[model samples]
Target: MGAVSAPPLFSRDFVDDPYPAYAWLREHAPVHKTRLPNGVEAYLVTRYDDVRSVLADPRLSKNAATSFPGWRPGRTGIPGEHRSGIAAHLLNLDPPDHTRLRRLVSKAFTPRRVADFEPRVIETADRLLDAFGPEPVDLIRAYAFPLPVIVICEMLGVPPEDQPIFHEWANGMADRSGPRGGVGRSVKRVRGYLKELIHKKRLTLPADPVNDDLLSALIRASDHGEHLTEDEAAAMAFILLFAGFETTVNLIGNGTLALLTHPEQLAKLQADAGLLDAAVEELLRFDGPVEFGTWRFTTEPITVGGAAIPAGEPVLAVLAAADRDPARFTDPDTLDLSRNEGGNLALGHGIHFCLGAPLARLEGRVAFERLFARFPDLALAVAPDELRWHSGLIMRGLHELPVRTSSPIRADYQAH
Candidate 1:
């Protein structure tokens, strides 16, 4: 059989409803060549097995610095000078460096550690919901976006007052369709803010660093030994601030939208709250936050799903596509709350798996539990087709999720 020809991978049609095209690629061109929105030639690994394999393959290097000259990795258009700091994040590093960077903050995000945030997560969710009036509200702005941002901010010791600043910076960086200058400026602002924040935290280092938050711990790590450089520390903070909340924001937004559209599953979850865990997993598998894994470059010629990709070419594992692969899940399109097939790549696979997965899950569970419990008749304010999704190749999130809280609460309830 010959390779399947499809629309540009980053086309609006593909962004709006990529499943049909993904299905075609999976069956006919699993290891397909396509152009990124920036006009960079790349190969997309679309099938479940291949995507899982490519994610863990050492030959597919994450460090674009090692790629052949003239082949730049996919970026948000941040300039090289400003990029060096934030780009030092774990997502852009290969083994050793990647391993080192991940280990520094991994303990803070452990299952037990993340579970510790349950009380705060619930409080934040409820507080946000309480503030919502009876009328229709953009759930993305009112709840999904702020909840995770606040939680992550609290966890990292970022001032609650500065959340608006972080949100502005993050939005600019995440806008892949925006001008390069704008994205570059956002990156610079965030990097500068992190540097100042880290410096301030270091000056006030608590008596026992171990008792401090993730940022303080990172500062201690850099202060004590060669574990992390100043640049790397700031980069780590920037990535955590942006990547941490951004993905969860989408998970909550996308997952909630999914439940709203699938009333049966929503009803099932609302009835038996115990199914929250499985439901969150199924929702992630069905249509999770990340659309594709971060950019990777082939260090050597590699063949995936029968297609040979040359060395130095960029590669991406379409997690959104792989999770819905018919070969992997039964009735892949159906939203099954009890789905136990497991191994969904929504949070990704292998060593570079999302460090924030535990937090994301906790947030999702808390968000859904509080959301449905507070407003049993929660629903979309507009038609399903009227919703707009973010136009980015890496992240899959709704721009705004307008929803109506059917029941009105007393005005005093808003005093939280």
Candidate 2:
């Protein structure tokens, strides 16, 4: 019999529960070609092995200019990236340019730097959770969203007064389904702000020798031998902010929801504090924030999962589906916190693996540890089935996570 027509791909229902469709695709059409809502046609690579291979394939290029010959204005790539002059960052480039930019930024975003920032992450998490009452509250708004926003803001040296403004623009820029005009405006505004901020930092470079923020580091790098252009600097900072916070938001939100739904897993995590790290990994593998790998265009004809993809066509590895492939994982559907397996595409694989993985892990580990420690009796306010997920192909996150503490606390009660 012929292959079954790909189950209604990327619809609202699929957004809410894509696993079943993904399973079907994995079994039947591992390299299924489908048109996205924006009218861009591409091949969706399913299966763990295929997804992993596709992510690292040299023949598949990430450079939008060279690879995406069918690019649609405002519809393809980040909205307004070209017009805002922030399109030259790592994600949109390849080769020597990608290498140079990533190396320069990595010098500042070191493991020691992330470790030093742990106290701040814990402080931010605790502060956000402190405001919660026994009554139901949307975790996304009160906790998940703002925690990372504040962390990234502080790291980027955005002043306290400007944080709200930054958050507004981030929200606007992140809305994948919002009006194109709104996204463009947000991108332009952020670009303008970054340009001005960079200029101001240059003037103070001599007087402000103690400045230690990531933005300051970038400016100094450019002033030194790094040779980074202003546009490149702004673009790198822009991607770092968006990439740093956006995934962590979902990591906390989705991971929390996963534990809340799977009481056994939650109990296991509660029983052993050592499991926090492993639990985060499991949560990421089970339902990571990134649903699909970023777009890659074929530089030459390639066969993925036995399906031939011609040169110049765009391909997306279904990270969500690949992570759940039964063949690659033992009892893949089961959420085992102690279960250890390698090569989950949740954080991605190969050269383009997420640059912010270390920071994301730190935030997720701290967020969950602080949250559960504070609210041991936490329970979902809404039925699990009633929860709504944002309708986007790239990000997998809840619209809101209404949760409440079941126990009454005295005025003197303090979070540990």
Candidate 3:
């Protein structure tokens, strides 16, 4: 047998199916440095242990402001993050600041709160699924995308009518292949809307505002001397909405695809609703929405997977690759709903772990349960090879999932 050749990185083909290349990197060069699409040179860590260590490593800082000079934000950093005043969120800050900010919003996403939001999630999922008839429809547009957007909007106290606006802006920004100028415009629009929304909320807030929604809680915190500024509030809101929905959108989309393609797994899940929670975890580990962890910079010299990295250089831990690492997972490529293994870096690991994870999981479980229950005959409208994936580095998701409730699912289809 010959060694596998290095797969092209960030090309259209690679975007559609990046696992082969990731597998090669894991085997051949676990910590390899290469130029990213944005033209920044960074170390790509592909092993499971290395990714976890790198993510939790204080030497690999998350604060982008201190990155080496001449390094542009490109797709890695949010557009107009500083000028538009949305740069103070969790993704960009290191500790103390990160700790303080996370504390303020932590109450909204606690396990108890997320569990309490279950009824709303089920109602929202059912409402969205009801719109789909027997005819073929793009599930991504009709179901997967809007469910999370609407849920996040509810959590943030945004009016129901404003959700469509959020859907448009969020869709625009997630399209990294779209015109750069267009993405910037979408970012500006979101920032402006958030700033105004914060101002409007502040005026109507009661003497002791109830913490029903996250934004209201943030405003109350700011007013009560938590030192959270107006910009910080807007920044936090922007991050929560943007990060919160996109992940669940992909989770529902990707997990559905996983189930639909893997008939045995699908049947196992269908036969037993009790397996829903474990299935969600397996789905996340099998093909998670997060492809790579957010950009991290080497705060000081460090060694990762035998590769010595210098200070002030960019680094990316391939989350999907790490989750698929053979060293950590048995038959890593196979999707087993009953797989009892843990330690998937899908939401993330350590202090920087995704704050919205509990919400995302609850949403994923409810979304899948409702989706299959509503349309047991649901099957792919197109062949697996014909599907297209989003060409973004940070997240993994399908562009569209055409499905039909009228036709019986094909049993012999190969899993993607």
Candidate 4:
């Protein structure tokens, strides 16, 4: 029903619905040169197995700028020198550095660490829901955004009153990525904020050991000479704060939108709490938050879907397409809560796989479980079509989901 023959994979239309474009490329030109808005050559790799292979392949480094000379952010003449700093956040690091950096804080993200937050997550979620009032509420403002914003704020040891600042920084960072956006201001502000945080940590070493948080962990890592450079430490903290909130904000918002759109499955979920995890996974798969995975650059010429991928070109995998591939998933477009068949690129795969996956999942399950349970009568406060989606090649999420609850019964019940 679609173009089985290879077609131009770089059109704006393809960027919007890259699945069909990806399918075409997978069938025809797997590795083709295309120009970005900056006119640099990039390779778009679309096959599911191929994406996995490429991500795992050591030859394609994430730090493509150094490895490949011409790569540049769209129109941001922010010299390649500055690009590496922006890119060095864990996502861009490879090998010994990546391994070392990840090790420094991996313990903090463990099941034990995240699990300890369950009670707080539930409490915080319930409080946010309770504050919903009787009026139609924007879920993003009410809970979706605040919860993760709050979580990351807490994780980083940001002062109790300091969430709004971090939230603004996250928005600015996202905004800067926009075509005509100005991020210099945001970058400067966030860097200043993190520098202050580092200063605070240095001045006040923790008196108690177990009160350790992400900040303390990073501080400990840095003090041992295994210490990251000041810039590296600040960058990691910045990455944690933004990545933590932005991803979860989308997960909860996107998941809720999916449930609202598919009431039957949602109703099934409300009826049986046990399906919550799978339902979250299903939502993550059906209309997952991330549309594409991290960028990859080919170090050597390669062939995929039978087309030549020239060396030193960027290769992008349409993760959204991989999730919906009919070849791997039956009725790829349909949302079935009962089906246990599992496959998704939502958390990515291989070495660059999302380090915060467990925390995101735990937060998601908490958000949905408490959300539906609290607002049994929750229904869209505005027309479904009225909702707005944030524009991004990477994020998939609604700007707001206004839902209202009328049932007094929702409040009378307690899982606590």
Candidate 5:
């Protein structure tokens, strides 16, 4: 018999529901080589242990400039000038540079700092829910998108009115089509805005008390002359603005959809509010925001799960796949909130573990708790087959979760 061909990596089928394909990869080709959406050849690590190992391996380089010299700055045709300023943030660095950048930003996003924002997050959730009347609404548009944007903006001291602009820029960056230099234009606009904001902050010094937002903290670090440069500071702000809200938005959106589909779990969660933390973790495990870890290039030839990946090749740790690997999790396909098997790579692992994890967790806990409490009868507005997933290679999120807040739970929930 002939060998079976590998499934298409970036097909519409893969996007709509990736778990099945992920399962196939884990069982057959744990270390699979595939073509990226942009037609670049890359290796994918799918098994749980292999994915974790690849993520923490120091031999793998995050800075594509050093490893993949021929590679250009942006995937969506972003301009060179605009790309470097934003791409030089913590996620794109390795070793000493990554360490230095992370340490400076870590201070502003410590667990305690994120804890202090809980009340504000809850308040924001309340306001969002209050604004959402008892009717069918696109939760992605009405709640999931705005709550995190507001929280992150307020923490960064960004003017509330400028949020729509950020949203526009983010949307453009996320577009996979690379539509006529749209990504480059968005990058330029956001970079320009951050530069101007930093300049204004530098010109003014508040007496008695300092600004507590992250941007001010970053600015102070740059001014102190010991840590960050002006360009680095701008890059840090750009990363925070871009990565900060995008993940949480998908988390809330995806988590809510999970609960709505699994009415029994939702009921269990609503009945026992104490399960909020565990429930959030399960939601993250079941379907997290980030589909894959950021770019990592093989500094040297490495064997992962019996597959040899050559040096200088880009590697992606498929988080969604690893989390759902049957070898790792019992009945991996099922979404059981009560399951206590930990070590899900939803937020990633190692030195590059998500800096905003604490914030995302806090937001997720609050969002799920309040959302369920507010509308116990929430459900999907359209048939499950009718819903569409985002086409982006890195993000696994529904384009819009049209949900009926007031409708009674459907009888055929499990069929989805």
Candidate 6:
């Protein structure tokens, strides 16, 4: 049979529900190559093993800025001053440098440290639920969003009181508009706020000690603790805010929604509480928080999947669909929490695996446990289809989730 010579395999219909498009590609165009609306050609890597190998391949460097010509301008979402601002982080760095920088910060995010943060994470989660009273509320606004914002704020040595401002900056940056446009207004606010916050922290550092948190550590890492460039400091702070808050927001929101829609499984979870960990893992795998892995641009003529994608192209791996590929699992579509932990690409794989994996998992499990325990009769206050998803681009999240608690008070309503 001849190769399918179609246009982009995915259209509006596909983005709306990419599974069928992914299934089609997996069966017929596994190594699909196509151009973007912006005139960029990309090699879309599907299939579990192929995706894994491609991400792990050293041949495909991470520093797309220089290797892939002119790749920088459009990709960052926020352009201009903040373009360079965001570009400085480790996400864009590859190999020895990526290794070094990640190693320095990696100590703070270790499993034991995450466990230590559990009390704080749970406290943040509980306080958020507390705000909703005993009434059903929009879970995103009440629980998922604020909980992470507070925890990340504290982690970075920023005051919890500034959460609203921090959230504005993150939403600005994540919205993918240019810094001068959608994000800049918020970036400006975050930059401005961080500048003042940084100034205060410098005069009187937190009581948690120099090794207490990520911000102080990064500040000290710079030349003699005096050479951290203003932009560098602001950028790291910005990166921490966005990375620390957004992923968990979606995981909790999407994971909760998945449970509500799949009542039998929800019932099972309520019954066995032990399945909480597995359920969170499966939610990550089954529907997963992220729709696609962060975009990667090819530097050289990289032949991936089955096609020879030319150099300087943008490749996006649809993590959500790839997780459900039959090639990798049995009954991939079903949200079976009992499935083995290995059945997921949710945290991603290889070196690019999320640096904040431990924290995200900790927040997720803790958030679910407290939410369910607080409002045992928690349920959807609106129709499932009526719930709006924060548009499909860089992130996937619910605009709101209203829930109702059957009782005004519970025996164990203590904030963690």
Candidate 5 minimal-lDDT segment of 10 residues:
407-416
Residue-level lDDT tens digits of model 6 in 248-290: 9889999998888898888888888899898889888876777
Estimated TM-score for each candidate: 0.93, 0.96, 0.93, 0.88, 0.92, 0.87
Per-residue error at 199 for model 1, in Å?
A: 1.4
The digit string of per-residue lDDT tens for model 2 on 1-416 reads: 12567789878789889999999999988988888988988899989999999988888888867777797655567778888888888777777788888888887777887888998999888888878887899998899989888998888888889889999998787676578488788988988888788778778979999999878888777424666666777898888887778899999999999999999999999999999888889999999999999878999898888888899898989999999999999988888999889667898888888888999999999999989888888899999889989876677988889999976543454544
* Cα lDDT tens digits for candidate 3, 1-416: 12555678999888887889899999888888788877777788999999999889988778777765546555467666765667778999988889888887674456786777789889888777767776799999899988888888888888777878977898887776687677778878888888888788888777536647767777776324675667888888899888888899899999999999998999999999999999999999999999999979987889888888988988999999999999999999999999988889999998899989988999999999888877787899999889999877689999899998774433443221
How many backbone clashes can be found in candidate 2?
0
Off by over 4 Å in 6: 1-13, 37-39, 70-72, 76-84, 133-136, 174-180, 195-211, 221-234, 341-343, 414-416
Model 4 lDDT on a 0 to 1 scale: 0.73
Q: What are the runs in model 1 whose C-alpha is more than 4 Å off?
A: 1-4, 72-84, 175-180, 206-211, 222-225, 410-416
Clashing pairs in 2: none
User: What is the Cα-based TM-score of model 5?
Assistant: 0.92
RMSD of each: 2.7, 1.9, 4.4, 3.4, 4.6, 3.4
**Residue 189 CA displacement from its true place in model 4, Å:** 1.7
- Please name the candidate that would achieve the greatest lDDT relative to the true structure: 2
Positional deviation of residue 40's Cα in model 4 after best superposition, in angstroms: 4.6
Order the numbered candidates by TM-score, best leading. 2, 3, 1, 5, 4, 6
Query: Which parts of model 4 have CA positions greater than 4 angstroms off?
Result: 1-41, 73-86, 175-184, 206-210, 222-225
lDDT of 4 by residue, 119-190 (tens): 888888988887888888899877998898788778778887676887776666655335453555566677
Candidate 5 structure quality by residue, lDDT tens digits, 172-214: 7555456767767787788888888877776674651467777
Error of 4 at 339 (Å): 2.5
